[model samples]
Target: MANKDWKTFMIPYEQAVEELKVKLRAIRTEYRRKNDYSPIEFITGRVKEISSMLEKANKFEIPHDRLAMELEDIAGIRIMCQFVDDIETVVNILRSRQDMKILYEKDYITNVKPSGYRSYHMIIQYPVNMASGVVNIIAEIQIRTLAMNFWAVTEHSLNYKYKQSIPENIKSKLKEAAESAYQLDQTMLDIKDEIKDAQKLFEVKSAIVSSIMNDILYLMSLNKIQEASRFQSQLNKLIEYGDVSDLNQLHLLVRKEINRFR
Candidate 1:
């Protein structure tokens, strides 16, 4: 009966989580539309389950009445990035937001936890406009690289399974894995410029392929079947020979073909 009541009380927090997730995802969409690099690879959020909340309250010896005031992470958001430096970019973006006030930050990345946990955690006070009135809720945001998230996720599962008493051997292995993930992130950062150039080439090639396909369809619709076939055949050869990568070069080729058809 108490758990049921707690679930009902958590409705606002659940709404907050969903709202924040949508907003963060929209930021990612904005970056892609501008053909810009986005530090956030993805966003995920969740409201704490009643049982988990209760467990945490009990662990902290919190009275029932103090639960709401003390529990900051009832609403949580996680942003995953591709590189460790990207985590700093994400933090800066959050800090610049006017909608939510950043209460404080915990830099676990610089000073890793004894358990080998590493992430950047921020506590923010977000206003959730209610029908009755505006209520400010505290939400915790954690940012991590893909590799750091992978290790944290695995470690979390093991902690749950062992109830925080993981075997020594397993713990050692996890520590090693965390170190390896850190090294991998560093290596990626070292070659980030090259990786970005390759990605830009891919996007350009994709755009050209899509434009060529549309042009082929337009020609076919105008009963220019022979012209369409010739254009498509040449396009296939160009793609097969790995010729279309630069946007300017693709535009030149497409312009010549388009002028011929028109």
Candidate 2:
């Protein structure tokens, strides 16, 4: 028996991820720029694994001079979104692209895998021009929530540890744990707006504090208390009431501080 020449076709993992990222961004940016779509929300591509390679090799024999795609990814670019509604938005984005061929889709969020794993997967075929020639490769794109991904990571580690012979007790415990994780993901989604609001407050406060310190650096020098106090009225309100929505209020506070001091 002769050894198959898949290596010639198999791209280095780094280059494989990089090329796909570029390909995705190129088309997406063009679409948004041409159509004037605001708030670009989705990102793509991630590192691959050896298991992915073996799987592909076994699935399809490579013709001479062509590379094989092995898409074993552990951290696999799972997009952790804020809304249950956005999953379809991401899927539609992928479907609309002319450069990509939608191989298949499984909506595990609506119809979860029997093991409790929830995600949307598509075996997309996209063209990449390699040194050999133009080639199309299959990259499995999975859309999921941050909580879902976290739970999945923990579950995967346990599966590897137990070597698929998970003890009955542990299996039951894990099933409960997965349910808890699912509840957490749902809770997070339910409070997505609140989470975003809190995150914005944190970002805004950090920005203002840094800005105040920087501005006071020249004249105030090491006067920490005065500098902090200088923006006292504004800082007090922003940080104390972290959970805010009105961007206008924040903007006005910043403007007042700059006008008063500078």
Candidate 3:
């Protein structure tokens, strides 16, 4: 493809990446809006670089005309999770989505790679609305725990740096590090409930504090400076050394004051 042709070719893939990122992020936001833990901690996406795409096409013997059809990762989305179990949850969510059609899935987490790389890959056909018409593009979604992602990212950097010819000793060390990261993930899983509970408590407290602060600001806006100042001083002490119950009480008091003003 010529330079201009390549740019034109990438337009739909870029649109697909941006659209998928927004949709996937909305899932996380919806979960949080309901005061629930989201399986997806975060999402990131990209359209394959021109050089990388050309390299892969050459390596795989894919013809330029068939690149979009054969190159599944031309548009890639990575979903990062806090726990290993969350990968399955995210996969199920994607499978249930109506916006994209799942072509196939690769369960690398269950069947770890020889190089100790682990991730769940989903190949999906997503429809992108172009100025010309609607086109279905192949996209790859990778779901993995934070530890797995960290290890994979390091491994990818090494592979790039070594031009896919990593030294045996370094490869061995990388494998060992991958195992360590998996172990860390497993250890976290063992205490997952406790960690979740702690996080929930923190979020609840944060929400209450936010409500209290907003109400205090409302008082100041109402020209009740002395009252707002008093509440602000109390909030400062509570934020420094108070628990959730204390914050709840302060929030209730602020709400009552706001109600009186209204």
Best by lDDT: 3
Local error of candidate 2 at residue 251 (angstroms): 9.1
Clashes of each: 0, 4, 0
| Residue-by-residue lDDT tens digits, candidate 2, 90-144 | 7787788887687788788888765677777877665667777766666667877
Query: Model 1, range 1-262, lDDT digits (tens) per residue?
Result: 4767877678778889999999999988999899998888999999987888889999999888887678989999999998889999889988999989999999999999877889999999998887767778889999999999999999999999999899999999999999999899999999998988888777878888888788778778878888778777877777767655543454466567667767
Q: What TM-score does each of the candidates earn?
A: 0.90, 0.66, 0.96
C-alpha displacement of 18 in model 3, angstroms? 0.9
**TM-score of predicted structure 2:** 0.66
- Pairs of residues at least 3 apart in sequence or in different chains that clash in candidate 3: none
Model 3, 29-72: lDDT tens digits are 99999999999899999999999999999999999999989999
**Which candidate leads in TM-score?**
3
Model 3, C-alpha of 259: deviation from truth (Å): 4.8
* Local distance difference test, each candidate: 0.87, 0.60, 0.94
Which ranges of candidate 3 are over 4 A from the true structure?
259-262
